[model samples]
Target: MKFRRKKSGYAVIEILLAAAVFVTIGTSIVYLLIDSGYSNLQGRDRVLAANFAQSGLEATRNIRDSGFDKLTIGNHGLALQNGSWAFSGESDIDQSGRFSRQIQISAISADRLLVTSNVNRIAGISRPLNITFSTYLNNWNKTTLLPPSWNTPQIVGIGSTGETTGNRNPFGIFVLGNYAYLVADQPSSTGSEFFIFDISNPQTPTLTGKVLTGKRVYSVFVSGNYAFLTTQAQGSTRPELVVVDISNPATPTIVSRTSFNGNNYAKDIVVVGNYAYITTLNSNSREFIIVNVTDPVHPVTTPVGSLELGSNVNALNINGNYAYLATANDSGEIRIINISNPAVPTLVKTYNNPGLADATEVLFSNDKLFLSTLTNSGTNPNFVILSLNPSDLSIAVIGQTQLAGNINGIALDEAGNQVFTATSLSSQEFVLLDITNQAAPVIKSSLNLIGAAVAINYNGSYAFMAVNDLIQQLFIIGQGQ
Candidate 1:
């Protein structure tokens, strides 16, 4: 017991062996942790690559949906322009710059295309990491337009009238699909300012629904499931832009109203995608207003500042990224404002009416402005065509026509060879003219109405007219010989 003698060589060797085993276990754990971390990183990279590849394919599909002509046979990157997808560059990189994506479009047929999306790691730890997807796209854009018809116009149906007061004057008329929406100044018997009619049967446009939007609804522009309207401001703080949900033709609901504080009231409105460009009767203050209607329920105003037009704006039309304004300015009856940069709208050009008359209604087609002016010299070219010079953005009046009464509303056929306009005259208020020869357009047909046709629209086959008459507020015109 006293002699804890010198340990055996085997015991010393056993101790060293135990230490070696512990060291080996510790080293194994360290390597395991490192490998686990690298595995997680690789998994994350693969997920991101897959997501990027999927996005590339989706964007290509969007381009095809918009216009198949854009999908050419080449590798392309994507750029979002005016809330639309467009091809740009050769390849696109991820936000972190760690990955690159390319969309390859190949022509499969005249109406069909092959899209191949490829994504790969371009930076950081890369030992061959790639993701790919492919899809076929078809032109689905084969649209058969409404056939051309210059037949005599007929008042096929009469719907929407006031049950209480004398008359609810119709201010705006829009025909979309099988429905025609009319916004009026005075509320009808149902205390409604918005009326919806079923035009599937143009012969008998049945009054389908009505929404009471107070009074003095001045203008309306329908898009998809909603109708954008401009109303006379009830109070200085009252919103002038009203959004109505017409998802249900039998029952329309007023979802939202936006006020950009443009002027006394919103005079006209034009919606392009998610934004709504509005003008007011403010000659002294900011008249051009922009509203972000992306969220149709809760619209945000002044997102892209406002512009002072220096004149009372009567009507507004947006084509591409430009906004055409019909103003009361004697010198600048037509104001062409560039809206490509929505944040700051600049006046590109202005045109004076032939008789220096104020513009009442305006439309643009093929770089030409189809305009109607206020009362000038009796029958002194109230309606004129203003041509635009692309290089310098200059304006020129090429052709003109006149009516006994002021032309209040205008419409154009699909081919752009025919134009339909309504006047304040009690008789021959609806007139159609052939514009094949731009220098001098000839009237094709004219129809007499019960009262002054204040608002009018054409849909290839039939012409719709909204008159100021009390008995027949809506006159559905049909094609006749």
Candidate 2:
């Protein structure tokens, strides 16, 4: 009679319900714990990566200070390889006649090798460095006599002692190799002179020479011994393309001059290998023309390539076999062209951007194409990096950086790792960007040029800027010992 009550174990439905509730609670708790653990790991990994990047930078500085002259690729710190990190080095030349070393480091993750850092060094001339082993650091300031060979930069603004307020403005600047030249649009009462400056001494840049032109010089391109000037001619809609022999840095003589009756406004010109690629908006034709300038004096028009664009071509940049052109009055995109065939340049691709792009400049560096948008998103600027497949001529937007001012002109070191941009829409300064990581470009520092900088060109070590009043100034940037 006793145990017989046969304790009918709890009903099947009740037991099943209890088990279901327990399983649900356990699953939620496990998920939360896993998520938290992953988050913590990610944060720690990021911190470690940053520290590693900074360490690599310091290592480069040490090597440079130690007088390891001519450091190139494959010459990196072993500490970087000890961890999940890697780096590459390159030498860059700026317009200021200074040598710069660019080192890029990346972090190795489970799925990706994320680029995390860039280090720039101002490589001093390769001379016998004086070093002594000591426990104390030497005071560099003790030396009152600065290096006589080193040069600095000064900003020059528009002068109106007795002229109209807005008569002439510095519109363009060009550097004939290491020398600098400034061009003013329709100078005030003064002739249309290309004011040349001696940048050998960057700080106190001396105005070397001034040459009068047939028309207002809009843009210029410099070859080995010549400075090609693009002029905006009046009366005749067609602009004159003049080539001046720049063998003499101070005084340049016109070697060849050609007037295109069809194209009225020639925007820019670029010389590559042995040919000059000119971009212009012909008043009558209403298209961009690619003219042949292999023969400077008698520049003949070859098979002209035209793309159906809305506005005139404003900026053109070339690297290797491709030509990047920017068209549109205030807002536009960059068109990629295959210029392998000098006579017949073919259109490869086009990128229609929504950003308010006025003067777009492009440069190729570190296997990436950098597009600097002058005034995109109001006054805020941005540097767009495009991953370009040189083999197929295809481009994809990979990395970008938004900044504070409008960019006018852009320049880069030989490796395209260090980028310099001139601005006008804001404080009229020059910004330096570390583009070693093409996908995540960063603005490392900015210099207050104190003028509306219209154009910039770099030769690896120095930066040459075209500021107000058709004045060209040179700045030497980098950590100097």
Candidate 3:
């Protein structure tokens, strides 16, 4: 039996061949699994970068819509998360104008891996929301307007020892000579009120006069001896523009009035050399109304230019012979119009912002146009500035900053060498900025205001603002304590 178990065995070559085949198959499987896993990881990183960018955009929009006005010139960071995923954003800038770049960095992560995004916010349209329109004439709060013995520490700065009321709203402000005028679109359930203050002294302000308007005075502009006002009418029958003669200062008389159709709404006014530029829009189009007011009583609509837009115009600014207008839509855009020849004006340039931007206001100074924008893409909102080439109508990025709240309007104190931004939501504080170097702006102060400010203006030494509230008051802003 032992001898029968002899040799019918396989050769060494056969055993070697089996071993080679097994090794080849195992190696192919290992390579396939590793390559597939790497490809998937790369795909996930790209998605994270995109999402981080979007988060920044959204946060900006939400702050703006909620009425927080803390935007300024500095790096602002925000973070967002969902489930095990998280996103973060940071924004910064240097210089201004068309070439100025605002770099926004966003970080996204899942588990131990991280991804990022860099975005640049361009120029566009922004306007204030939840405006306070009222009619009152005291430089005090509700207690000062008519009543309970007021006993709050006197506020130092601007024109007067007191402001009309504690609540700020009216959404409009104008400065002429040493005097500042504020409009309260809503006042004690009556109507809008115009409060005048002598801001000759930046540290100690004084109240001058007050006028009660039958309607909400949405906008106000001062030129020479008159302060032109526009009211938000409830219907077509109400006149929009209510020209007030401020020659006497104490008594503001309505010299003339103008009305528009129910569909068209009058939002803002700018008084230039001898003309008044007004912005009006509806669901159809946004148009500029050029009115010849050499004779204030006989105001004539010299020329009206219509603009075609993807959305409505939110705010407008005029510097010299150019009109800088901000509009909102899927993409925010800034349109520059040459108003040298008002009758036959032309569009010189246009800039589209990178994300959803609702430009509340456009301000031009030091050859730059600052945009107060709101977005819903990130956690913290943004305040953007662009360089302007008035000659070619080219807009470049000059500088940008970010903030914690929604920014509505900005004011520049050239003499104080500072910039002030009004926030509408959360902490209603006037975020102060140092613009010693226009290219590199920074935060220097954060003065607290009483209400939601819709518009702000500065006359080198003093700051003027309008807020949203029942007792809409005009505030004489000073440096923060």
Candidate 4:
């Protein structure tokens, strides 16, 4: 009558099953909590690493701004001691001790420094993470003007215009007939952004017309009754090629606009016949893009027409069936591309010389190539003249010369037998060279200006120079004896 003792207790197997279920659930919850905490920590570390890397870069810039002599080649860490900034030749970290920072200063030239900042962190969950930032710092304040002996040139009518502050930097210039077009940035102002000046009187350039592009223009090229302009790339606004009809320059209108993809930035352009050859920098590579502009109102880019180069292309020139490019980086190279077939451009040859590490501008005149280069780490020629054998793509160095500063722009007057160069670092901003003796070129005159000479264009009697100083924006240099 006991009913088998009512199975007084559940079977041992049942109790064991219940306990196993509870253990499994508890273990899963604990593991998930641990994983979430680890993920949060890893993300925090990454952000901290990035911040430290940026701080290192700023510190290096501060050192550079303080004095060029303060920078030296090697690993360095910024330390604040005695209410002053100092550089220590040791790897240092923040208060957390989890992030370490260091900097490397490499001398690219006498006045140029390539700074690299690095931050490292190790969290044990993965391999060490390293973040880096790099930039070139030039001694913009250093003025190394050598007194012009006897034949030094002089600037006659130097004038200043435009906004002195707030992103109103004048950058590009193009002269056609009696008018000169200037592209500048007017970020804080209204109205037209591009300006037209009546340079018919070089001594007094009067502003006659202006047109708005709604973006910062970096370059301008004129042909027929139209003007083609390239703008700087910003956040959501990609770099573009804009066509403006200037049949009546007083009232210019935008006709066509073309946008580029994948971090493409337009630096300079040259037009030949019905095609426009543009040199651009795409992320870390250089590209040559050819656009058919026969229809000015509807410019079309050639299909699969971009050719990649070794490094950034600074300046380009087109002659006959060839395009010469000045590609630069730690080293410089001159690339010749055959563009006889606009749709299919081909690289013909490349030339590299010891003194050609910083080729900034290139010009072709009468089978001779004028390459404006910068000296390397040591003493080398900053300007080079080469003879181009079109049939074989062979180049021979005819003459080489060194200047007190880096040459940023070059222009030639074939009829006058002169070469005008705009320099950045020298005491003289404008240099007039007599290339009449191709093999033994002589400097006719050098003039010191108020600002760094960035771009120059010669039109028979006068040289229009784009000056990048806070005050003076442009200078009209007349030929002086």
Candidate 3's displacement at residue 428, Å, is: 5.2
- Model 3 has an lDDT value of 0.58
TM-score of each predicted structure versus truth: 0.66, 0.60, 0.60, 0.65
Per-residue lDDT tens digits for candidate 1, residues 1-481, read 5977786998999999999999999999999998767765765676688778878988888888777788889999988899988888999998999999999988877777879899989897746788876767777776343443455455666675433353467888888889998888764445788889998887668888988866688888898889999998734478888899999989999999776654567878888898988888874678888878998889885547578878889998898878999998888888888888888888888877767677888898888889987667855688887788777877777788887777888887739588888888666888887888888887888877757888888887777888885435788776642
**By TM-score, is 1 or 4 better?**
1
Residue range 1-481, candidate 2, lDDT tens digits: 5565654566877888999999999999999998766654443333333334445455554443444332233333322345433333342222343323334323332222222233222333332211111011122223353452212222322221111222356667776544676666764445544666666655445666666675677788777777777777622344467787767766767777666565456678887765767676546553455666777766764424544455667788887778888766553467777777765677777766556665457776656777776566753446777787767766778878776666777887636566778876444387777867767778766655535677887766566776663122333333222
Q: Model 4 over residues 67-184: C-alpha lDDT tens digits?
A: 8888888889889877666798666788877788888889888887888788888444465677775666778676465553325454555444444334555777777788888777
How much does candidate 4 score in TM-score? 0.65
Q: After superposition, how far is residue 266 of candidate 1 from its true place, in Å?
A: 0.7
Give the whole-model CA lDDT for all candidates, comma-separated.
Answer: 0.80, 0.58, 0.58, 0.74
Per-residue C-alpha lDDT of model 3 across residues 333-410, encoded as one tens digit per residue: 577778888776677777766656566677788788777765435642356678876566677776666666667778
Instruction: Give the least accurate 10-residue stretch of model 2, judged by summed lDDT.
Output: 129-138
- Candidates 2 and 4: which is better by TM-score? 4
**TM-score of candidate 1 to 2 decimals:** 0.66
- The number of clashing residue pairs in each candidate reads 0, 12, 69, 3
